[model samples]
Target: MSNLPKTMKALVAYGPGDYRLETEHPVPVCGPDDIIIKTEGCGVCVSDVKCYHGAGRYWGSETEKAWVEPPFIPGHEFLGFVAEIGENVKGFEIGDRITADQILPCGECRFCKSGRYWMCQPHKMFGYQNTNDGGMAEYVRYPKTAVISRVPKELPREKALLIEPYACSKHAVDRAGVTNEDILVIAGAGTLGLGMITYARMKNPAKLVVVDMIDERLEKAKDFGADIVINPSKEDAIAKIMELTDGYGCDIYIEATGHPSSVKQGLAMVRKLGTFVEFGVFAQETSVDWSVIGDGKELNVLGSHISPYCYPFVIEHMTDGSLKTDGLIKRTFPIEKWEEAFEYASGKYGDFKVAITFD
Candidate 1:
């Protein structure tokens, strides 16, 4: 009904060190097939840390590197209201609430056609190392394909903020092939690990053990329904996992911590033929015990990049009250205070998922 302003506030990353609260940014321009969203909430993901702190070097992709551009906005996990929908856009209207998938694939790519859009030859990521400015601002511009789903009216913005990360955890669980009979072990009780624990509980696993070095996170894991919580700092985690599995080892292991040692240990804690799904991003050149993996242990190693077809399922479960977003969300910050938000999310403030809210 009125003309929008040209400049807007954003949390901009100049190069790589940290984020700054910037107010002099042009609102993103949209193409005929694109939509502009007025950001409502943006979750601070660990990948934001990797991108800004150079921990994403392991990805080895020029697109990613280019996407994580200097002097850019940074927040992929977010929900927003459709501010303006370009002509030709269908099924969505201005003022509609929605969240983004973050990782967009070229539908024409062979990998995408094969249903492995995460591995698309020309992959496009949001608020990462190489795509476009993210939602840590007043507005975010996106293509129609990037929109995952509309937010439920019953879901709080804070709870809706968990959608992206939840989608990721869902993908990891799906890859692990979690079943009621499987003994699920999640490495790292961080946000992703915690979500994995919570979502894993929905599958009614026979046993669920979450491992973390920090007591607070372990407690959070417990709150999320982990049957057993292990503190590696005080005890042997691998042995504890083995004991929990009755010396048989866990049937499925999900690695949500980026530490290489944890990855190697996750591999070790799996049953002889168990599946190991990696949900964390390890730094460049991080080595693993491939020898054991290649020793014909029948190990299945899966690398999940966000979620391809898991969004709808996550939304359904969340809408049906199967996946709980409470407790997992720590706090919220106004978009103007994005620096403080990023700092809090980077573990400087505390262990929690710090989200930036527009309103």
Candidate 2:
């Protein structure tokens, strides 16, 4: 503990489209019930991109209040080693590899009392508010109430970093209720989309289809066990899906593309009584036909939020190699190159996931 520095470098978000890499930010103190972590790596998420572009869902829109308050570090998907353990904390030792559930639920909330903590009214996420400084830095503080799990030492940093996103995808797949007889279509091949494919494949679905505009991602999806890969930019996606499903369309559609058009496409491609799981964070509102969900198709639409109780399942899968991680993390950058890393992540540039690593 004597060797620990008083301050560390951190990426602070001041407001929409405003972020600064501060070299001398205070190293968070470990409260009696908190633990400090030395960040190993942090993955960039699509929400981070939306926040960077000043999307109203994160910043603020006329109808919705903003989720992010400024002057806080901005990273949620990360893994690291325990740096300082609090006096009252138990079951964790110094140097233990760990990653936490980003959402900190207020146990007193009604939803929390009902065991639905994911819907806690006053929940705080690690990366969005000052109270819980995020992992885009040399260190981060894990609150007493934060749900944390230890990572196996055998797991590579790149794969460990995927646990969070994979938990989210797992929850979406679970919600979709996929079975061996079901034909599943994942509407994107990005990190989360690919994560969905990884977990959905485990269900041994009759067929797993992946759709993406990028050929590289489509190929990667095929390598990741996708039975079919579609390049929507070149092929007529609706027509191809109909032909593949023999005009019945897909039994389940998982929408991971944030583009509004994907929502409409899912509505059009899913068969009557089919299930649709919406897992993307959009920049703006999408207009779709309400009748298609009710009278026209009677489809079952589900919304997937952040990782809730599925962290352990994801970690277990990653530990056993059931979840493929090779080539998922395409690039890594040191904290000094945050701007470059952020631009590369935002551009997508034919990459799956980008990470910021600490020395």
Candidate 3:
């Protein structure tokens, strides 16, 4: 405590287009059961970008509570080193590398009591709620209720930075329940979709088809484990999928693209009784014909939220090199250049991931 700085640089969100980098933000204090860490880096997520640019879902309407409680930090995909452990905290050291689940579940909730903590009734998420101060700053505080996990020091910065998204992606892939006989379609080849490809590959699906607009991401999809890649910008992706499956439709469709079109597209590309996993966050509500899900296709539509019971698997496979993330993160900038980093992240510098690094 004596050696740590009193004030540190931080990125604070006020409203859309009003995020400021404050040079004198006070260091977060550690409570008896809380943990404080020196943030090494934090990845900019699509939701973060959407919120910064005034997405309606984050802003909220008269109907729903605001997803973003402003005047707070806004980063969930982050990695840090334990700088200060609370007096009552255990199972962590002063210098342990660590990351946490995006969710901070209340232990007494029905979901938490049933071991499905990710779906905790309170639904408190880091970077969104007022209670959780996210890691878009030099130093971040993890509350007493945070579900923290130690990251393997041997893991590369690129992979460690992706643990949160990768964990959610793994959860979506697991929900798909792909089999060797199943033909799987994973739409979107960005950060989350690529993680789905890596994990879906382990399932040994017969043919893994990837759909995206960018040719480069489609190429990267092939490298990850896709048996075939589809560029909807160049051709009719849904029709091509139909032909591939001999008009029977794919056995599993995982929608990782946040676009509303992807939801409708998955509904058309999957066969009756096939599994449909929806994991992406959309900026607005998606409307579709109700019959397509029940009467028309009778599809098994499943929705996946943030990762639960997956950090251990992610850390182990990432350390063993089973989950590949070579060349996933495209660029990084110092905390001072956050605006530039986010601009490049919003597709100016390709559709890959961009991160903000802290010294």
The superposed Cα distance between candidate 3 and the true structure at residue 228, in angstroms, equals 0.5
Clashing pairs in 1: 67-129, 67-130, 67-131, 68-129, 68-130
Q: What is the TM-score of each candidate against the true structure?
A: 0.91, 0.96, 0.96
lDDT tens digits, residues 113-197, model 1? 8877777786667775334778888988887557468777677776788888888888888888888999888988877777788
TM-score of model number 1: 0.91
What's every prediction's RMSD, in angstroms? Answer: 2.6, 1.5, 1.5
Off by over 4 Å in 1: 18-20, 56-67, 129-131
Tens-place lDDT per residue, model 3, 178-251, is: 89999999999998999999988899999999999899999999999999999988999989988988898999
Q: Give candidate 1's whole-model lDDT.
A: 0.78
Give one digit per residue, the lDDT tens place, for model 2 in 1-359: 43468999999999987899999999998888988999999988767877877888778888879888788899999889999988899899889999988798888889888988887898789899988888899999998888898889898888998998899989999999999999899999888888889899899999999988888888888988899998877989889889988999999999998889999989999999999999887766899989999999999999988878999888988989998878988799998888778888875576678989998
lDDT, candidate 3, residue 28? 87
